[model samples]
Target: MQIITASQALMPEGWQSDVEIRIAADGRIAEVGPMTTRAAHHLDMLLPAPLNLHSHAFQRAIAGLTEARGPDPADTFWTWRQQMYRFLDRLDADQVEAITAMVFMEMLEAGYGAVAEFHYLHHAAQGQPHDDPAEMSARIIAAAQIAGIGLTLLPVLYQWGGCDRRVLAGGQRRFGTDPDSFARLHAGATRHLRDHGHADDRLGVAPHSLRAVDAEGLDAALALCPESPVHMHLAEQVAEVEEVMAHHGARPVTWLLDTHDVDARWCLIHCTQMTPQETARLAATGAVAGLCPITESNLGDGIFDGVRYLGANGRAGIGSDSNVHIALFDELRTLEYSQRLRDRSRAALATPTAPTGRRLFEMALAGGAQAGGRDAGRIEAGAWADLLGIATDNAWLCDRHGDAALDTAIFGGHGQACISDVWSAGRHVVQEGRHIHRDAIRARFRAAMTALEATV
Candidate 1:
């Protein structure tokens, strides 16, 4: 068991002072009340850490490599995807594990206690499966274990190249798997996690997108994981919406809602192209809109309709999709800033009772836990002990209290520097703004990047 005391902590009802949290042997919060005795760990300000609902961990390796202008005058998500594919062709399992470990460690330092990896890189360079079909999935689970970050291993089902059902070519070959093969792969991955993963680890399913999986394939993937979290890329780009419309006779979200029962278990990534009606309809379904503001902006994808969606009582959470940047505060601030820039207003997401920063933080906490299917995002008994520690003495947080402290952490510059500690399911993996295994992770990542740079 582990004991932690906080000068202030965000409980389910609201902020509490002089709070104590107890972690059971199973890593769940065992108790939450006033601090009466000394504890092994102490925090100045504590908040429930949010899960990153969508991530392609290997893409962290290509962060700065795709910034230059390609032959196209207007570089778009498609062009960036081509570069990403080319880079992944040179990656092996060891390199992928190293890169993923670095990404997970960075996420912990950034205050994300857990991640739902939308993993699709399944095959080898030449599109051949390894002896164990789920070798790549095992590596991802292993990396999560090494980083001590809660894992939601989403084995992605990527079958076709487009809505036309074309064969996957080039770097896309690594992600190709039919429904039958994907079932085997999913089972293999499940066995690995059951045998090797931590108690908080989870398994989820992701159909790459409407374009990549036909109706029959999507049904098969859904059948493989009946009750687990179901995530998918939905209407991220204009071209994608158009393609889905041209092929399916309706927009992505519209067609999806009409065809499938998209309830709370579903997390739709990047509803950036949704109409107002589609937004309202999706919101009513209780599905989470997984927003990756930085990656959306970096890829030239249009801004999501946050005001309308939230006003309709939608669920939303943030993710570092491309991992071009991995700062939690930046993600939250960028989300609000995008809404502000779109509407020419300030505090666009603020409510009557909650400030902008507080509202966004709480929404993310709820939506992330729902999307990842983790029993977390609250400081209460029976919840996973995923917590973020903030140092009130930092210059960015000086003299701040209550919601003002959260506002400063989100809006103030150098917010990452204010992060003092992080716990994922009672594992204190990050301390003093650094991951506990930072040096080793950094060294391995550096070696992997050096070799990858030489090749690509």
Candidate 2:
């Protein structure tokens, strides 16, 4: 058992001060109160570490490489994807393990206690199935294990390139699958996880998106993992929304909500192009709207109506998709800034005297855990013992206390502050601002990237 005290912490309503949290060996919170008499581990800025609700782990390495536009002046997500295809061809199982470990390390340091990896790169470059169908998925799982981050391994079912069963293009080959192949691969990946996944690590299903998967395939994947967390890329781009409306006679989320019983079990990533009616209907579904504000901005994707959606009481969380940026503060800050820009208002995420940081943290934490199928995202008894520490000793945070500290961290601060310690499932993965496996993981990552540079 361990009890750590905080000068400030994020509780249900706002930042509470002089709080103590007790963690049991089984990774559950033993107790949380104003004070604790228990003897054990201690931390400084203890708060609920937010879950990274969506990621493609391998994209971390190639993040900066896609900045240059092609011959066309207006390159977009479709254009950037060509670079990604070439990047993945350089990765085998061993290389994937190296890359994934580094990615998860960055995530852990970025205050993500857990990740819901939307893994799709499975087959070889030519689209041929690997000897082990889940070879790539296992590599990602291994990376999570190495990093000691909670894992929700979502094996994506990408059945088609379009509405028709069209053969995937050169770059998409690695992510292709028929429904039956996908089902088999998903099962193998699940079984592999049962053997090697980290404790508290779990499995889930991703239908890639409506475009990458057909109706029947999506239905089957959902049925296959009825109880597991279901994630899908929704309306991120206007182009995608147009395509969905063209094919399905409705927007993606609109069609899905009307067709399927989308409850709390689902997480719809990106839902950027919702109509007023669709937004209202979606808010009633109780599903998490997984938003990647920074990534959305980078991809030239439009913003989701955060004000309208939250006003409707919709659950939402953030992710570091594309791995272009991996800072938790950046994601949260960008989210609020986007909303402010859209609404043309100041202090968009803030209330009269309430802390915007606390509210955003609470919403993201709650929604992220719900999306990842975890009994966490809170500093309460029965919640998992996941906490992140910030360095109050820093000059920028001087004289700040309680909610103001969080306000500084999330809104005022721009880059990584001294994250002195990070505890996942009551175990310390980072101490003194460094990950336990940072050195080793980084070595492997260096070697992997060197090899990748040779090919890509």
Candidate 3:
């Protein structure tokens, strides 16, 4: 058992002062109430850290490498994707683990308790299966274990090159797998998670996108993991929406809603191109819209219609899709700012009862937990003890208290310097604004990057 007293803590009811939180040996919150003299740790401000609903861990290594303008006059998502493929073509198992560990550590330090990784990179550089078909997946799982971050591992299914079902080509070969092969891979990976992963860790399936997997492929993938959470990239680009309409006779989300049983278990990564009608209809479903505003902005993907979606009571969560910027508050700030730019308004995501920062944070906690299939996102008795301790001594937080501190953390900050400590599954992984294993993880990651820089 562990006891921690907080000067102020954000509870389900509201912000409370002189709060004490108790954690059970099993890593779940045991009790929470007024402070007691017997305390093991203390915090100035505490907030329940949310899971990152989507990520591509390997992409961390190439975050800033794709910023240069391409030969084409019009550089777009397609061009960025080509650069991504080329970068991944030279990645090996060791480098994958190193890069992933660094990214996962950053996620924890930046106030994310967990990550739902959309892992699609599989096989060797030459497109051959490794000795263990799930070799790459094992590396990802291992990295999470090392970082002490809760993980929802979604082994992605990518079969084709486009919506027309063209055969996998070039760098795409490394991510492609037939249904039979994918079934075996998924089974092995799920078993590994069940046996080796932490109690809160989960396994799920991701159909890469509408462009990569046909209806039949998606059906098979869903059938293989009937009860698992399902994630897919949808309508991230105008070309993708247009291509899906051309090939499937309807927009991607439209077809999925018409055909599949998408519910709370489904999380669509990007619906940036959805019509207002599609937005309202999708909001009616309990499924979450996984928004990665930083990466969306980086790739020039259009802003999500947050005003309409949130007004319609839509569920949503944030993710560091490209791992370019892993700051949780930055993701929240970027999300709200994008809406302000699109709607010509301020405080666009705010609710009547709460400020914009509080509203977005609470909604993300709930929606991300739902998407991750984890018993978390609350500082309640049964939830996992994943908490973020904000440093009150920070200049931005000096005069702030309660929700005002959160507002500054999200909107007034450039990074996560205000997040002084982070606990994942009751384990103190980050303290004093850094991960516990930062020195070692950084050394390994730097070595891996140095080696890959010469090759890729």
Q: What is the C-alpha local distance difference test score of each model?
A: 0.94, 0.84, 0.90
Cα lDDT of model 1 by residue, 226-313, tens digit: 9999999999999999999999999999999999999999999999999999999999999999999999999989899999999999
Error of 2 at 334 (Å): 0.3
Per-residue lDDT of candidate 3, residues 108-219 (tens digit): 9889999999998889986889878888889999999999999999999999999878998778889999788999899889877887788889998999998999878899
- Model 1 residue 209 distance off true place after TM-score fit, in angstroms: 0.3
**TM value for model 3:** 0.98
Can you write out model 2's per-residue Cα lDDT over 157-176, one digit (the tens) per residue? 98777765677887688998
Ranking by lDDT: 1, 3, 2
Top candidate by lDDT: 1
Candidate order by TM-score, decreasing, is 1, 3, 2
State residue 42's C-alpha deviation in candidate 3, in Å.
1.0
Q: TM-score for all predictions?
A: 0.99, 0.96, 0.98
Clashes of 1: 0
